[model samples]
Target: MAAEQGKVDPMHQFAIEPLFGSAHWEIAGYNIAFTNSALWMAIATVALWIFVAGGMKRELVPGRWQMAVESFTGFIDDLLEANVGKAGRKYVPYIFSLFMFILFANLLGLIPLPLALAGVHPFTFTSHFTVTGVLAILSFAIVLVVGFWKHKLHFFSLFVPHGTPLVMIPLIFMIELVSFMIRPFSLGLRLFVAMMAGHVLLEVLSSFVIDGLNAGATFGLIVSLPSFLLMIGICALEILVAGIQAYVFALLTSLYINDAENLH
Candidate 1:
């Protein structure tokens, strides 16, 4: 049933609708449901595979896919080298993967059908805060892991300022520690909130436009159309944000790791 009819369960909005489910099918006692996110992920994987495979067997002069992939790879390489130095080269794969996953996910959501699916189920298990939150925390953990792994106990000394008063050492350490702990929280919140709020705003604005048109109020309809258009522009902006947030997460992570490796 359509969401407008109220027959759809709002809480089930996040549930993954599989192509089919059967009594014999299971994965570790968990129902292996096929979700839109998973579908997008699979699509991303296939797209990446095709791009990479094609790039490998390209002509002497690059074709469209080859050039596009090379350009993206080179752009990332340059960004890392410029920002984090030669040492940052090692993290290129991880950063690239993060950026691609996020970029495709955001792009896929822009498709009308996927956007409609989101409205159909708002309270599904998949809609829980955990998925995106976990992704953010995972990224944060990678940064810290790389940092401390490279620096050892010396990494702990990061909290001590280079030229602080002796009396302020403890306070500085406390503040630094608290801030460090909050990194994951902030990272996760930023992505989750952005995704949720952007989707909600788009949905609400669309509803307003429809309502305005139905009411026969010319000004309201006109204004609502612009608002709807603005939402579309914002959706495009969100695509950029997805790529940016991924890059920022990786870059900051590289910075932290660099500091640790250098014992700074």
Candidate 2:
């Protein structure tokens, strides 16, 4: 209906607009400007810093904030250390920060305010690829670092299984190598896709909710009802996705590091 009204942009779903552009810095011919992605990332960083800092002052009988912080970090730290062993303790900060950043970014979007309300920068923070893509690359780099640190010359053996036949060695090596290379791609794409997809659903539903009220069509009312309900459902699921994706990314990174350490 909004499509018929000609108010909605068809390609607004994936557009990442730059706030301002300049020759601030260049990497690989791409100029680094203050973009929406960068802005939200900064917001995420500041928000996380403040949120965690507020809980940093611990007491013997911890308050809600202190307890929450302790529990959150303890859970991730324990899980990683248990599965990945003592060496994995080195990654506690990285994993914990990743989970917290994503959780804040996801929750930030759920802030209820009028769509036309000024001073709101939802687009800057939500589902921005540059922010997420860099995070993915960071995970990839950590795996590489840990693998090399632990296994030295033998880490390359990850490309070949221990019991593979000589005839199948080359093909298996290629397969494992490709799969290894694709981990970052899969990780980044999954999180970015989930964030983007969820926001798109929310926006489309909101459009229906608005248009239905305007048109007074019975079908519009029906569509709007489910759209509102689905928006609520997606919001809840997105909260889970936010934390889970961050955890999965960290978990996989730790496992890869462990594999590099064990090399078997």
Candidate 3:
């Protein structure tokens, strides 16, 4: 029981550890460690590929699986079209991939897996700022490049309102530029904060249940019942959050692109 108390650290799951234990290596004078975060990222990528690519087919009369896949495709298509107008057609594939990858990464952490093999751990990539920061930066870069490619110097006008006073123009530009630069960090932070909080909450609840069961008393079991039920409810909520965060990330990216294109 003391060992269990020692092991039940809620924030321990977020720690990034090397895959090769202490057998560390360096390439070109840089420490290139294969961490648990990398393992789960690769897992999420392969799972996404198997799910989406393996399911592709050509059939006029679609089966249930095919229908579900098509529905997802159509849903993303509509999202792109609605948010970015006709120009958004080119971005459907990118947005769809981003959404699915994030959804898979977020949900992978909720699974209670024994990852002790080969120096691995249950990792939620999206819960880490490093992972989410890269994703957000990539999306922001795409919006910036495409905006300038399509509109050139006119893209700068995104900061200025349609009818701003001459005196306020410079102030508005500074404000807008600051907000624009903050978007990627904010996007990444939002996902990381939410994922980290949910997982920690689950960990704390599970620890209580564990302690109760270890007690081996009727009252312990009785109290643990409600804790178990609460964990179940939290699991369901986390699932919903997983999907919603993916959708929200994609939606916000699309909206940013829309603003860049239309300058509103």
Candidate 4:
């Protein structure tokens, strides 16, 4: 094991350890307990609330905080309107919350605090498939609910394009149906993999930096310097990726909702 050998384990960051005692609340043979992942998620949710609440002051002439929030709101509004048209206005609240939650969660994970000295480290819940999968399923469920509620059985027609020959109907329907079903998995996997990969890379580089320094000054100069610099660059890239992933998830969710809203 990397840890036993006095080396950093890149994968150790992803471990889901309980925050409380070792004993977990079990129901039907499954352990359910508060964890670092849950703690970070709760923190992100609270942070989002504070951010949005500060902006809700409703100044006659908006301040910087209000302006920042308005800018994000407008961005999502425009995205929804472009994809789903006027009806999208009603869904703005849901979509906006979703986007902000994800954005905050992603950003929070990258915060380098001194908590490690207190035996705490920031946890990125989005890197976990369980977290991402639940978010994806929630979005997908909304699409299904809205589609069925609004269009009833006609929603099934979404799998069939506007134009297709009778001979190709079966093949096209199966293909489209399969693609449709894969959306949730793809959406969740995208965020999970992106977050996980970035953190793993950072951890590995951090190990190199530590090991190189401990080995010798020459090795440190040769390996640690370059790795440290690359880590900085990668950290910057990861921040951008965090934002982009949130936007992509929101955009794709909006697009999927468009299909439910307009049968596109």
Q: lDDT of each model, Cα atoms only? A: 0.65, 0.75, 0.86, 0.92
lDDT of 2 by residue, 1-264 (tens): 445665554246456556756436678887787766566678888988887887789788889988888898898789778878887777788888877877777776555556437655465253666667788888888878878887776888999998999999999999999999988888777777777777777777788777776678796768778878888887888778767776776677677767776677
Q: For candidate 3, write residues 1-264 as lDDT tens digits.
A: 334555578888888878867337788888778887888889999988877764587578887777877888788899999999998988999899989889999988777645545545668989999889999998999999988998999999999978999999999999989999999999999989999999999888877887787778775678677888999999999999999999999999999989877777
**C-alpha TM-scores of all predictions:** 0.79, 0.86, 0.90, 0.95
Candidate 4, 1-264: lDDT as tens digits: 677998999999888888777457788989877888889999999999999898998998999999999999999999999999998998899889888888898998987647766777889999999999999999999999999999999998998898889999999999999999999999999999999999999999999999999999999999999999999999999999999999999999999999999997
Worst 10 residues of 3 by lDDT: 112-121
TM-score comparison, 1 vs 3, better candidate: 3
Native-to-model Cα distance after best TM-score fit, residue 204 in candidate 3, in Å: 0.8
Q: Between the candidate structures 1 and 2, which one is better when assessed by lDDT?
A: 2
Candidates 1 and 4 compared: the better one by TM-score is 4
Who wins the lDDT comparison? 4
How well is each residue in 23-122 modelled by candidate 1, as lDDT tens digits? 3457888866665555666776677777667777557898887888888778778767876788878877876776666555555555564555666322
User: If ranked by TM-score, best first, what sequence of candidates would result?
Assistant: 4, 3, 2, 1
In model 2, which regions exceed 4 Å deviation? 1-6, 10-14, 18-30, 114-116, 124-126
Alpha-carbon RMSD of each model: 4.1, 3.1, 2.7, 1.5
Task: State the TM-score for model 3.
Answer: 0.90
